[model samples]
Target chain A: MSERLTPHAPLTPAVLAILLSLAEDEKHGYAIMKDAVKPEFGGITLGPGTLYGTIDRLLRDRMIEETGTTDNERRRYYRLTSQGLKTVSAEIARLNAAVAQGRALGLIQPKGAR
Target chain B: MSERLTPHAPLTPAVLAILLSLAEDEKHGYAIMKDAVKPEFGGITLGPGTLYGTIDRLLRDRMIEETGTTDNERRRYYRLTSQGLKTVSAEIARLNAAVAQGRALGLIQPKGAR
Candidate 1:
């Protein structure tokens, strides 16, 4: 278990989505939002309040940090810190466990059976 | 996509855990809480406020329904509706996609490598 995840209780859906968006590359708030709306993230649409608030909290927690700033505030780029990566990894592990449990209990269909 | 999941946006962590707990068998609040503390649910501890509040909402949404009651109010058993099952299955599928994305990005270790 990642230390960050345990203390944080559970990451909000928006927080996890933002962290995953930054896993591969630095992205600004809008880019994170766009990525979150992709199928992998359950097509979630984050309102401005949620997007920026989660980003602010993540920044404060040192899970992510600003990588660059632009004249346009919306272009400020951010990336996951090592801590963020670890936390996200732990969360993915947790989600995988849930998936496994669901499978065992016959809640989820086997692969290719959908 | 499950209609319930979409309109509800994202299910709260408590809601998802409660739904999963009720998936296999009818359980009262205490039983659900016990199941939640098990490793598979990430050892979450839901307070009474969150537990019963979420249960009320799930009942309102028709995701779960009371099955039986004991002398003690805490022993009111609940089970997932077909709709609840579908919603939970959909949520598990979404989480699976996130896990797969994490793996593709090398955020999660491959099985047995942890």
Candidate 2:
């Protein structure tokens, strides 16, 4: 059998979006779903199943951890761990490099360089 | 049953890297594999099975099309279709937005903003 891929090796879009949502502050599942689908953030309308599934994977990888519940008691908030912070930072850097390469190849224009 | 997701709706990192590699010029599988594994591109070392599997899906989705073979005859080159071009462009825009959000939230620093 082929070796299984790492949990976050490729950082799927949904997972990245979820990580970005929690990057600033702790948030519940619904809050994350809302933040992720904002038009400015690519309008990714992740269904509840997909959102929680990604969250479960992220949690298992130790990239994110659940803190305490909010006043609602049922709402569990999540935040990025130290490892999660480092992973997200590295992912951003890699993405930045990809964008730079895209610009260099002229497939994409530099921001405000139009 | 939940609706099946679009092939490119949430472009995976490996697929995005493959599309980026073909954005500039048509390349055979090995050439794409090489470009994608560069450290700057996130060091995504895709196995042969994984590579071909992605290629087949992309082809089935009409995101990429196989052109005539190179001089080696066994080597088949692939290029982005018009739809593929549009898809990649949109994916990049989404990623840019994510990066911008990451910066605004102080989760990540801007390029050379140190």
Candidate whose TM-score is highest: 1
- Pairs of residues clashing in candidate 2: none
lDDT of 1 at A35: 94
Instruction: Write down the worst ten-residue block by lDDT for model 2 chain B.
Output: B1-10
Best by DockQ: 1
- Tens-place lDDT per residue, model 1, A36-84, is 9986765678989999998999999899999876658659899899889
In model 2, which regions exceed 4 Å deviation? A1-7, A39-42, B1-7, B40-42
Q: Candidate 2 chain A — worst ten consecutive residues by lDDT sum?
A: A2-11
DockQ of each: 0.66, 0.49
Candidate 2 lDDT by residue in tens digits, B14-112 = 888888888878999999899889754546887798789999999998889988767787799999998888877777777777767766766667677
- How far off is residue B45 in model 1, in Å? 0.9
Model 1: TM-score for chain B: 0.85
Error of 1 at B68 (Å): 2.8
Q: Each candidate: RMSD to true structure?
A: 3.4, 3.9
Query: What TM-score does chain B alone reach in each candidate, compared with the true chain B?
Result: 0.85, 0.85
- Full-model lDDT, candidate 2: 0.79
Model 1 vs truth, CA RMSD? 3.4
lDDT of 1 by residue, B5-112 (tens): 444556667888998889878889888998888767656789899899999999998999988666676579899988898888778778778888888888768876
